[model samples]
Target: MSEPMSRRTLLGATAGTAVAAATGFVPAPATAAGNRVPAVVRELDAKIEEAMAAYMVPGVAYGLRYRGRDYVRGFGVTSLDDPQPVDADTVFRVASTTKPFTGTAVMRLVERGRLDLDRTVRSYLPGFRTADPAASARVTVRQALNHSAGWLGDYFLDTGNDDGALARYVDEMSRVPQLNPPGKYFAYNNAAISVAGRLIEVVTGVTYERAVRELLTGPLGLRHSAFSLEELPGVRWAVPHVPNEAQTEIVPQPAAWAMPRAINPAGGLISSARDQLRWARFHLGDGRVPGSDRRLLSRRSMHLMQSNPGPGGTLFVELDGVGVTWLLRPTAEGPKVVQHGGDWAGQHSGFLMVPARDFALTVLTNSDTGPTLLDDLFVGDWALSRFAGVHNLPAVPRALPAGELAAYQGVYTGEQIYFDGSTLTTQFEVVPDAGQLSVRIDGTEVARLAFYRRDYVVFPNPDGTVGNQRANFVRDRDGEVTWFRLGGRLYRRGAEATVQRRSSAPATLPRPILS
Candidate 1:
């Protein structure tokens, strides 16, 4: 049997007064009270410490930009082995949060008449083909950017540290099975973003990293942002952390230090909370580089990046639609929120903004368990609602009858393509447990699913309470359950015995994320 599924597959905030009373975390007094920390920020600090304790996260860096006021701060140590206090400049891998940067780069190129969003993928990279040739040809640049490519998105291939890494990665995408036709559905496809990166490389005649530096980060003055480990030596950087085998402590990952070079365009970014706030500011602004009149993209282009909704919906109420690498969460009669997030092996980062309100919030944590903290602060409680008056109210789950729940029980399969081109198959077995659906991987229970609205279900936390993240069951034209969509990847249903034989050995599962 192969190794069991690792935890990278599975991927809190408060007010001060009531928070301190509950968690026993006293907020530090602001210097002299002339600049007393905002009550919401103090509450956030208390909540951060509380969440850090609860999730065993070693360190975190958070920031907020609301109505022209700015706040950025860090907490805990960067690394336990050789500890250093984290500060605003301490860098953490922003992971898939890098998607917006890629999207911005494409927007810049489009404005310059170098690339077209409506063009077919093969028009830019002639070799771009998936398991379905027609679907591959039909896929547009916009479809890839908005993640409607209908192919495998959880692909991870370490295509070396050379300049040709992205090109090599896209060449192997030919083997990925297309789950839906082009523009038919939206699954968070990382491989599609890598294809977009290869397209950037082909258009600019430079590596994806170089193109981004020239197009976005360099122009935006994100001094502390970079895609390379070499640049890390001169600055303070947070080491990635994961839970111990007992799940009691957060420790630095042993060998999973950096992601494969090929996936850099998808989720390989190291940035500070301060820099991330600056990025959020640019997106919220009028398309000019901060402190300069030079325009990287016109205001119209920037708005299109955030406003143009894709045809396929992301299956969440808060997330109204996907736009060029950005998730749009439109609040009725309130601000329109544009956001994105990243999840690496042991780091979690999120960026959220409400352009009309001139508000943005960023959270970066140095542990694989960071999502719980994000759940409380950005998505659930204080930061988003306090700063922008935006809330992502979740659906209330209801008890389902055993017969209705049994329809979801089955063996489903997903795959991960490694650097050397070997594929790791992951099996998800859903069976009825106490009138609810229990999700298992290789007989190990990972989480339970309780129905909420329609085909959507909410994942109950370890304490038997529901969280904000939701997954859904997809049915075919004939009303037969055909797939399970979680964390933006499609797990196709298969014959029980056939799936069991193929999944005899467990493999890495896709980390469920909110991006």
Candidate 2:
């Protein structure tokens, strides 16, 4: 009879020497080591190649840090037109991944007694207000960081790139509606995070970019990171790309110059793979500044930043919960995985770390399809399982009863969400077809929906590369479907006749041109 697999044997089989050395599971190898370095390199290369072929992403820069050693690699050309190959130093726009950096800066201020996470936004800015005055007055710094502030988070107005940008953005929030009361639900709120950035500036008496540089980049020696393309002068960077109308070929996109400077605190940091790894190490380390013993944030504050304060709806389902600007998911064996993903005009990036195993991974790509490469390629899963002994099973969709599916077919109308503009009225029409459903935005079919669980539906893009984005249908007291929530905004179901009559009308918002 064969004995059951021991814990050590299982970990060794899954994670090899990376986790072993970090956890002191066994003696470290003196030369070449017990680590399957060659195998890992080969596996990563193969997966990147496969993903590039499938998703048609123009370029990818990836870095991995395990047990204090770093492994970095680049794949494909910077652009289909330029044909310049990517390298370790190639910078890419890191979109919402910038949130964690902003959050870290706030924690530093908290340590210095310059800011209070529990304090209301009105306390510091005094100009901050929402359509719902009471909720705006009650929303706290912590709520904004964790995305629990119930205001309509999709408000993305560009208030200009002047020194008063964030302040002006806050002043304009009076027109934005409240999705729910403060701290009542978790909706990813970029506008609220931008407010947090404004708070940082208020306390530090410096520009948001300068505060970020002095507090984070300078301390960590992140030489290749900056807030915008103009800041990284003469540096070789990846050009963004998007598919042509036929979806058969990619076209080069201009630099993301239109990205409002006001949102830089939320999703505007551009960085290279090398510096991003360093940033991840700073978080995974003992809350101390790199190359110095001085503490930047207390160990307790770091733990607090990674702790789940309340329920997170869809993210909670997949990742277990969300912390302050971090996504917290636990492996079956009980160790937690902390990570964040970023997306913008024509770029996608991801940063992930396993604190228990002292392992981290970062990937940056320049293409509208880049997100598909990160999620569908199992980049995070491969790193966690091969280096941290964490096995994350792929999520599968469940089939709903025909009757249940029929009830969800309707036309819903709501504000069109934008990253930087006043909200525009938009329409969503759900139509059942052959057991599955199709979602049309502004009369164009954008995604196909499948049942993930009760009341939740996952919309997979028409292209097979991108993974599913989720939506939840909310019912009233009498069990009638009243509203549907997706991308952190609530959409009320419209009367069938009314929606049908209005669906033919031209959309108020212009379709986003990748350029």
Candidate 3:
């Protein structure tokens, strides 16, 4: 961890005056009418600076559109080596934050009668399929957008970067095993979303990049956003950083591993704080092009994109369900806070909006620790409380009764599916420790588990903070624990001692079932 710096030191070193700007490319209303920064803006600035100093993030750029005003600012240097200060124009890989853009593009097509959300993948991308033939035909475009397609979502293969990349990606999906029946469960599936991007390409008869630009970014007048790094030249950009082996310092990662171009639709866009704010305002403002009366999408379609489809269970403590691509969390005050976050390699970015308040916040950072800071310092601490009126407190682990822990001790096995449709018989061993339970996969400790609800166990976040991902243990008619669901896929208990004894390292860590 980096030594914490005082706000005074941060202001003295890198603070800049906030600038007032138009909300979007179109001309409607000025985000800030006066030169003086608002109190909320000052508070957010201080919090960000404090977070940057404590987290050792090389740079951060953020913008907020609140109550008809826009505040955008940047702090610290772009890179420790370069020392070029970050500004509103500085671009960072938005990663999966790009999904909302693709979602908006699809909604636009839906409004124009060019596409149908209920249409199956086979109807559009005939080449798209899953290991289950029935599942492929049953999956619909809406399910793909909402991550309910039930296939493995973390498929991150690098098909060559080109116009045909999405097509090849869809073809590759033929090998991926379906995790759940279509629309039966919610799993954060990047491969499913990539298929949605391919659907956009097929329905519009244009490349996915071209479709996103023409339908969304181009209309919103997003100048510094692109599906690939090659689209933004001569523009300053932040490089991803990861902690060194000692875990006390940070270092830049190789550019090649930053983000794969083949997953462009799922999480490939490079954007700046300035451009992201405009994108946010577009969603908050009912699909109308900012600065003009022209409607990019019908208000009805815009609402559809933000509306929660069903009770898909929670991700974070407050997150309620999935919308088109937006994650919906209802506030205590009767309004919904719709948001999405993206992380690729070490770059972390968050886009959050409270439509009820006509407000939105965007944060972009260049460190693996950025997401933790974004949650701990910004979203979880300040943004949700101050703007959304929800005071999110850290969850305390409740001690389990002495005998209750014994019931969970056992070796469980399930079919683990890879991004490329490969499968492995995975084993999870739960052993009771002093009152707590330790979850082990193969020989490595995965997490310290605690009961969050009667049958649900929550693990800690990557930083050992309260985690949003959880496992719900299930029982059979005999009342014996038979299976468990984590990351939205079911893992059955080993059928016999032989299955339980055979264990191997997981190809990847289990992810949160929801995004």
lDDT of 1 by residue, 1-515 (tens): 11111222222122112212333433333221256577777777777877776666667888788667778888877776766778788998898899999999999999888889999989988877999998899999999998888887778877788998888888977888888988876788888888999889999999899999889888898889999768667898888887666544556873655678888888888899889988887888889987689888898999899987775333333466689999887564557778888777678887888888898889998877777677666555456678877666556888888888877889888776766778767677888888678877667776777787767877776677766566778887798888887766677887673445353433344554324
Using Cα atoms with residue i matched to residue i, what is each candidate's TM-score against the true structure? 0.88, 0.82, 0.82
User: What local lDDT score does residue 324 receive in model 2, on the 0 to 100 scale?
Assistant: 77
Best by lDDT: 1
| TM-score: model 3 vs. ground truth | 0.82
Among all windows of 10 consecutive residues in model 3, the one with the lowest summed lDDT is 1-10
Instruction: Supply candidate 3's per-residue lDDT for 9.
Output: 14
Q: How do all the candidates rank in terms of TM-score, highest first?
A: 1, 3, 2
Q: What is the TM-score (0 to 1) of candidate 1?
A: 0.88
lDDT of 2 by residue, 1-515 (tens): 11010000101112112211222222111112345566665676667666665656667888787766777777776666666667778888888889999999999999999999888889998878888888799998999988878776666777888889887887888888887778766666788888899999999999899999999888888888998768888878888886565545556886553578887888888899889988888889789876689778888989988885544555312455567788776576788888887777667887788898988889898877666567643333556788788865344566666787878888876663455564456566877765666666545565566766667765544343324345577675688877666644456787552434344532221221210
Local distance difference test, candidate 3: 0.69
How many backbone clashes are present in model 1? 4
lDDT, model 3, position 239: 73
State the lDDT at 97 in candidate 1.
Answer: 91
- lDDT by candidate, in order shown: 0.76, 0.70, 0.69
